[model samples]
Target: MESSLKIGSAQLGPISLAESRYDVVKRLLALLYKAHSFGVKFIVFPELALTTFFPRYWMTNQVDVDRYFETKMPNEVTQPLFDAAKKLGIGFYLGFAELSEEDNRIRRFNTSILVGPDGKIIGKYRKIHLPGHSEKRDDVPFQHLEKRYFEVGNLGFGTWPVFGTRVGMAICNDRRWPETYRVMALRGARVVVLGFNTPTENINHDEPLHLRMFHHRLVMQAAAYQNGMWIVATAKAGYEDGFHLHGGSCIISPTGEIVSQSTTEDDEVIVYDCNLKLGDYILNSVFNFKKHRRIEHYGPITSQTGVDDLIDVSSKL
Candidate 1:
């Protein structure tokens, strides 16, 4: 018999830019109730779960930009979520744009947090591998201004012991990279939770609309299989702010098999009974990182690049 951990992946649909914080919180509370009814111990929400994907528009006003960012985790608006989680005795992973003020200096980041069953924050991860352009470009079909509004994540990836499993987290674009999962796996993460807001159509590229879903599952599956860990990837799908997001939240086993997945581009939950011990079985046999990895031959990844050679000649105006 598999020693399973009851997990829930909540895939949120469209969140309009004009929606109020109160409305978002209500929806989140509803999902919490649903997860609790389903007997889920841990629920994973999508990236920027509280608001629309705001990076699609460029904003110069500080007040306007700060409206979309959360200054504190359990602030006035989100306190209900914490209260609900505690009431239900359920842990959850939530992602949002974080805004902090320290020493009168403002810092912004795309961040995610792992909250315990008691509503205490257990772990936090800021997105390090930020994608998209920093400046506004009128030529592109849509904007991806994540780099403009938020700073690169300073906190490196790390894992924590939770729910009888070593768990880790990554946000949106971080899931596309191998290092995000590998670093956490190296720390003995048996499960990795990731959230994304990926568009169904890449207006900047010629790839098929369905390919985004494929890549989403492929990366997580490979990472789980290669690192001997389970991967729970959730997404905010459907059209929001004139862009269509791909919807295919899923749970992948350590062997890379997708155990459970969301069926629609709506607010829905998919549950999985994940066996933490399966990671041990794979690590001891197939993917024993300490016994099989060849690190000495991969030094170029850390080698410094020449400043002049790194510049794009076509980028010069």
Candidate 2:
């Protein structure tokens, strides 16, 4: 396995409604070239990278919403990116809206793909943790309608061998959940790559604006350390059509340290040389699943999804 691999987080700026797919591909290509110059072997782009965060807008017409979803990857609009990566000998992870025909029905998903240096797709992940509500809310400044547009991902969390190391994929809200990383880590994933488009404001409750970015880093850092894996997170940030998304694109080491982070909420690339073995000490000492994990005692994690009523011991007390 390759001990050291350089990765890049390509954080994109706003992609307006007027911007064409061809335009977005051009921006992606520029970042690809920039990372190549820095000797980055792989790069990660943000969720819904091709278009504006359309889920925030309430659209009654299915036709209007379908335009944001891609029927097939590497079609005419995205082939250039594939071709460029092949020529440059770079691999990438990209998140987008996927429209697929499965189980004799058409379905949509918030999805991401891991592409090898040879331009072949290695693995795919759909966002299982679809956040926000399906119903429209006119009271808030905007809506987060992921539940309305996409079905929960059918493909479970998976890991794939990439650049001589095992890597996994996640998207947006999946980062906030511990189960997402644990599943992949159990499968021997040495690194996890993810992309997100998070609004600066929380529509669900009265939340402090600064906590948006704070929690973004908090979850990923904790997961990285606890799971003994590196994490590369990219964001579709800045104001898109006047809606603000925070950008704190970053790379975290297995030790839960921020190796590199983007300074702007715009189109920026941050690169880091990740040592796969950096987590060996952590895994062998504190987090060795084979030796230390006590699954027999952790029944509630998989057996239940939400909290159950606790047994009261008031009489004994």
Candidate 3:
């Protein structure tokens, strides 16, 4: 018998920075209800689902930055979401800004959590690929100061066995890197969840606006096909605080075909009945990493090179 899992990609519109946690939770609960109705075993929410993308602005004051971070996962505001999921017996993957204290030191992380069907926290993945700069730049229209606000993720890529399938997660910028999916695939992840808040326009580039959506799907589709895993990518889309975010959330199969996708930049849910056995088929064939990979030749390409290595200094000399 082939094993299968029903997963949902809950694509949400732009969350206003002024919106309270109560309002966010209400929206999330609605999505949960929809996922439950569709018999989805797991739902993946966008990065920073509870709050607006706050890293766009450069905040000098610590107090201002703290407003965007969550002190606890199931605090007063988020408890209702937990309760509803528990009642419905539905598992979910949620992305948020986490604020925690370790050894009397406060640490902040761009994090995602995988909750079991019984509402128990199963796995936590802090985003390792922190994009943008740490300091404020005057030339740029807006700042992407994620590096300044959050610490580098200490938790390595890990997969958990749940709903009879191995699941893994990554957030925002993590999806752009091939290593992110490969790490999870190496751990036997049949399904991978991702959440993103990508801007439609590039502030530093001269590229076309329409290319963002194409690039988004391209990277995700390639990753899924290469890793032989089902990918559920949800996005936080629409305009918020003068920035327009591109939203084209999708569910991709092991064969790299988009199974389901959201059409508009609104609150939408894309569900797919993912047959986990497809992973086995792909891995055994085209994506057979063990049988096909040539690691010895690839190692030299990844090695660090000196500045002179790129220049024909010998010819000049």
Most lDDT-accurate candidate: 2
Candidate 3 regions off by >4 Å? 300-317
Write the residue-wise lDDT of candidate 2 on 1-317 in tens digits.
Answer: 89999999999999999999999999999999999999999999999999999999999999999999999998899999999999999999999999999889999999999999999898999999999999899899999999999999989999998898999999999999999999999999999999999998998787776787788999999999999999999999999989999999999999999999999988999999999999899889888889988898687787667666444549987
How close to the true structure is residue 243 of candidate 3, measured as C-alpha lDDT? 84
Q: TM-scores of all models?
A: 0.93, 0.97, 0.93
Candidate 1 per-residue lDDT over residues 1-317, each given as its tens digit = 23678999999989998888799888888888898889999999999999999988888898888889998888899988988898888999999999988559999999999999999999999999888988889987788989998999878988988887788999988988887888898887888998999877675778886676788789888998989888999989999977888888999999999999999999999998888788777888778777888999655545533454443547665
| Candidates 1 and 2, the one with greater TM-score | 2
Tell me model 2's lDDT, rounded to 2 decimals.
0.94
lDDT of model 3 at position 197: 90
Ten-residue region with minimum lDDT total, candidate 3: 304-313
Instruction: Tell me which of candidates 2 and 3 scores higher on lDDT.
Output: 2
- Per-residue lDDT value at 207 in model 1: 88
Q: Which whole-number lDDT from 0 to 100 does residue 34 have in model 2?
A: 98
Clashing pairs in 3: none
Which candidate comes out best when scored by TM-score? 2
lDDT sort, best first:
2, 3, 1
Candidate 1 residues lying further than 4 Å off, grouped into runs, are 102-104, 304-317
